[model samples]
Target: MSIVQETPIYRFGDFTLDVTNRELRLGEKRLELNARYFDALALLVREHGRLVAKERFFEEVWADVVVSDSALTQGIKAIRRVLGDDAANPRFIQTVPRHGYRFIAGVSTVARDDTAPLPDGEAAGSPDAASTPATPAAGEAFPSPTRLADRGAAALATALATALAGTLGGAVAGLFGGLLYGFGLAHAPPDPQPGTASILLVLITLSGFLGTMGGFGVGAGIAAAEYAAGGRAAWRIAGAVLGGMLVGGSVKLLGVDAFNLLFGRTPAGITGGMEGAALGLAVGLGAHLGGGFEASPWWRPVAAAAATGAACGVLIVLAGGHLLGGSLDLLARSFAESRLQLDAIGHFFGEVRFGPTTRMVLAAIEGLLFASCVVGALVAARRPRNGLPA
Candidate 1:
């Protein structure tokens, strides 16, 4: 009979241990595991889903050394810790008293390419290694590991580029609104968390995404078409969307207090801070997304805004009434309080009819922001260096 050595490749849950290279990975982080502990893990994975006697372990793992029971126990503990395996209720390595260990866990197997030295040498190169091996289709790996790294680096660079594009685009799209407000294109309170900065932010961000997708779609689609997945454009668009949302909300917080002092009037400390934050996020997102000025509740863009605006209106009416007069007139005064926040721009579009002055102002501001966002997104999308996987 021929002896076939299992090349120390095993996976269970969100983990993989390469015995040959003495490496381990949990999620994405690779660990520098002790040799003995690594050996123990390797043995367990090789005989996964079966009982492995303790004597067999001693013979196979500790053939040269005469180690005490404590040494073995320590090694086992170290292995458990590295694997995040619980002794009480083992998730990876199972314990059996007066016997040995068993790895009764579900594991997906992949044949190691023995032609080359196990590519786990460099810790820094682990992510690139991990990403390449899991391609959706089985065909062939690229030219070299360097090529793979280049692809990953490109992907990350693209992500950052998209973020920057959204920020720049969002600013441009919202120039009109900012000018109208006499704040020179300011977002809500700059001290804020993530999300859209205002209705303009949302519209601009969305429009930018759409425009960039249309402009970049041809190139991205061409790139993606080369691969098995038929959604490169979609992925780029998704990145733009995510990047716009994340960047837009954060970037606008740079001068929120200044904007508040000049054009924003909310000054109630924490409450006002939160309001400013919400407004900033709303505006940032709307500006970056760069969609149309939609106010119809049924429309996806307008509907999303209306839902948020409605909730804000309801909360404001109730909270305002509670804070001011305690009359609980939420139903009656919801609209009056809601039409002023950065988000109210959506609610005022086509969905809710208001006085001429208010509607006209809202329309002009949204139209201006929307135009800028679309232009920015198109500029980004049209650029060839957009983050597309090679």
Candidate 2:
């Protein structure tokens, strides 16, 4: 029923992807490829040297459900890194921007039984290619899959911690906001629903996720692009900024359906809506970052997550209207009520209003998060393994 086992993976140029082994080999060395990216490779390699249109890539690879365009773009970037393919100055993969990618290489399929042991016997004929499998000099670094997995695991752990921390932190912040507004120390409510704090809690959590996903997604994109471009500052920075914006904005858009489903209707209260937006952002951001540091030393993911966590905190609070009044406050109340906190809790949250201060919150948080991402990305870009500085 599946081509995975029935159809053999073909080898081309110096690259080899053993579908049966679930491996991508370059000469005697197996390249480190994450599962999802590997899937993309398998797809392209199966039809080696052919043009894989962006639309087909989307329909075949990500046809599961509704999603934004960013995921496909990210996936292509990852594949190119592992394959040493460049979208520009095509060595292997040629990008027809606004269309698709074409893999242009000499494809030579080998009998699985004949070349299973050493990256397809004679597949790596170049002298330099042969050296990759040899023992590394004393302190030399090898980009092995095992090493990559270890790094990815560490990042996963940190991201989990940060996400949890953000959740708890947001809940606490929401609780206090409710208390403050309840003492009649805040603004008045426009309708009957859950409270402002309740709504903020949810949105803040979302914001944290988006911050995590966007921050880390960009960071990883920078890493991959660096791997391809040799860490040219201008190139990597361009990649990170563009990639981050695309992924981050896409994550925000994805929340539409979920919001409608969870709220049983378009959300109606103030505070409630803002909180939801924040939560979506935070969670997505966290996941994206976790993926970015997959090839770093085990500690890098934690560092990344921590960096993103800090950013998430700033964005979550600001993106909503807690620090200043904006549309965030206007919509937050509906979300607060959705949680169905006690009628009074809902009432109090609804009363928490936003106004002129909203712009200030946005400016401060935006500036801070932007600065953090820039610094973090630069650090990541400096370390060469893929496109980073050597």
Q: Tens digit of lDDT per residue, candidate 1, span 17-87?
A: 66656668876689866665576667676666567776555545543332223345656777788777799
lDDT of 2 at 70: 45
- Stretches of candidate 2 above 4 Å error? 1-5, 63-67, 116-176, 179-390
TM-score per candidate: 0.28, 0.39
Model 2 agreement with the true structure over 279-388: per-residue lDDT tens digits: 23432343345443222342443344445544554565555433212323444555664343322323343423332343343424433343334333433432332232
Best by lDDT: 2
lDDT for 28 (candidate 1): 68
C-alpha lDDT of candidate 2 relative to the true structure = 0.46
Q: How far off is residue 203 in model 2, in Å?
A: 16
Residue 230 miss distance in model 1 (angstroms): 61
